[model samples]
Target: MSTPYAPPAGYGDISFVELVPLALRFLGLGLKLVFLALSYPFSSTKFSLKRVLWRQFVRAICPPSSIRQLQFVCPATGVLYQKYMRSLPNKPPVISENIGDGISLHWMGPKTNKKVMYYLHGGGFVLPAVDGHFYMLDWWRNEAKKRHGIDFSIAVLEYSTYLIDCTSSCQLSKARMIGLINFAPWPTQLVQVAAGLAHLLKEGYDPANITVVGDSVGGHEVIFLLAHLIHGHPAADVLNLEKPLAGAAALSPWLCFGTETTSWKQHGHSDVMPLGALNKWSGWFIKSRTRTDDSYYFEPALAPAEWWGGLEKVAKNVLMAGGASEGMFDDIVTTEKAMEKGAGKQVKLEIFGQEGANHNEALVEFACGDAPGSTNYRMLEWLKEVYA
Candidate 1:
């Protein structure tokens, strides 16, 4: 049977260890709600409560201590983080590989370096990496071996907190670098990812062998990176991934911020993330004070149909999975339609479990077949077919 929402064995529920952070989340959430309510009289904006609450939880961990000055606080919090990291269950061995320039490569499973899966985790582009991400990475490695007898080595690029092509002088400007945590913007994040991918290609891994996957906002990065590759790059000097990627997968990606999405309104009813928080953080990360009516950061869904048609050379195969119940469900379906119609049938769309961290638990469903016709089972089948 599909595992319950409670974390797996030894990966216990948010325990007493999390009480302090939990308390802060509640406190911060209260203040945020109060401000949101007050501002609504003048602003009249709607957002997701759960997403706003989760943002508070992430902020407690990463903090506004700023990226450069993180040394001051890492000594105290890093130890606790390490301890917590150790408690997560069934993660594959992740080795830290320094790819330079604040872009680090986390290798999951063995060091074969072939059959690599490039991944990025999502926390609205503000939070630090979570062990759940590593758990999913490990699951990908193990599941591939179990189902298809293939040993897949996953390399995830964890981009830096600050970005390069910051458009606005708002929250993430160079001047804001003095003491604030500089959450990155635009092509900068894409460039850092490309840099890491370039390092892999340079080290002799075939571009056709690398499969890129991203979750939530990380999914947006994956799409953005692929789209930019097709369009010949927004800034060629910054990021022009000349070689084609084997495939790409976006797990319930965060798309369609500038435009209106039905899911943004129905988030509380389905998806785990609230649209309010998505709207808030996306604006900050994009550094756009005024919401544009179209094409938020060249989001593929908003772009012309030609963008999807160009994916023929950018990716060999593309897999998109989104929960039918997820807030982003409509957008995923929308993008999938575009890709299927415009990009050819090289793209496949699979509807999976309910939203939230439960997507990670689908690994169990794949292993046990507790959910008949589970999405990951099909996912594994696709991998075997393509990678064979």
Candidate 2:
């Protein structure tokens, strides 16, 4: 197996070196806000005034080039963990552990819980988990126990972010060396995810009791993991299962990496994340791979329906949710249908889309301090049924 990418110590901490870029990013955001205020009324997209402004802000902050340049400003997993701990109503015991290869597993509830939700967060694979993700996970755990009497622990996988573009190994100028560094990419994350599942199994948690939950790129990771389980990654360690996982919830999963799609043309302005940014992020992810035909691993939307065969061997219950306004809405719908078709009618799979909502709406609402929305309610009901 290849060595995992271990981030430099204090990589998350902001330094004087990052100040200039950070300041410039915020300044650009301020200017973008001014433009939004001036153009909201006359915007081409018929979204609400608030949504139009949000789309602009998301576009400004999420440009792959900008994120790669000012990556330190995005808080790391450790910082997110601390913030999540503080937000909890009842303090649980310290439950974080390093699970080899720079990956860490953080538990929101006690490990003694019988059921587990293994969570992978999404920030286009370049960003780290945020305060909102933790809030949403905590809410799920709390609500599950309160409403359905299901006591499940959440194991948040603190995987490495794809920060650098170090596909080239040749000697480079000092400028190029400083600007481009590959922290973790494609197969590295797949291996890390396999390690996480291996850890859970080693700790005596049955595969049938664990549900894999992911959002955005994190949701993409769930799909990647499922595909890996079926077809296996050449670089990643083998992850064998005695039984199917309890369930998997992929919300607003980035299924397709390309920018050309009907939804992209229609919801280009309605969604928060721009397709241009997604394309750039996807480039950073797959640049290091040697093979040319590995697109199936990164862009599952391109895979044939037959490629999803045997998905039932990975997870018993699958929930695929996306926002109707999201650019990848069609891809999500198509992928779900393909999964059902490939896995046959016997497979338990479902798809959800909410009108007027944009990618990962449930987590975004939790981040904004609102109660769980309709999608969250639906997911909660799904969980109750899965655990029952």
Among these predicted structures, which one has the highest TM-score? 2
Q: What would the per-residue lDDT of candidate 1 be over residues 218-293, giving only the tens digit for each residue? A: 7777787777666645443344446667788777676766535665455533344444555556666667322333
TM-score of 2: 0.86
Best by lDDT: 2
Clashing pairs in 2: none
User: Backbone collision count in every prediction?
Assistant: 4, 0
Predicted candidate 2 versus true structure: per-residue lDDT over 1-388, tens digit per residue: 1123244465545566656766777798888878878887787875555555555666776773444454565666655676668656676565667776556777788888889989988877667777888878877878888999998888888874344434454122211212112235456677788788889999899899999989998888898889998998887878889999999989999888765788878886656676677766677666644456567777778788899899989889899998887888888888888889999976799998887788788887776565567888888998997887
Q: Least accurate stretch of 10 residues (summed lDDT) in model 1? A: 1-10
The lDDT, on a scale of 0 to 1, for candidate 2 is 0.75
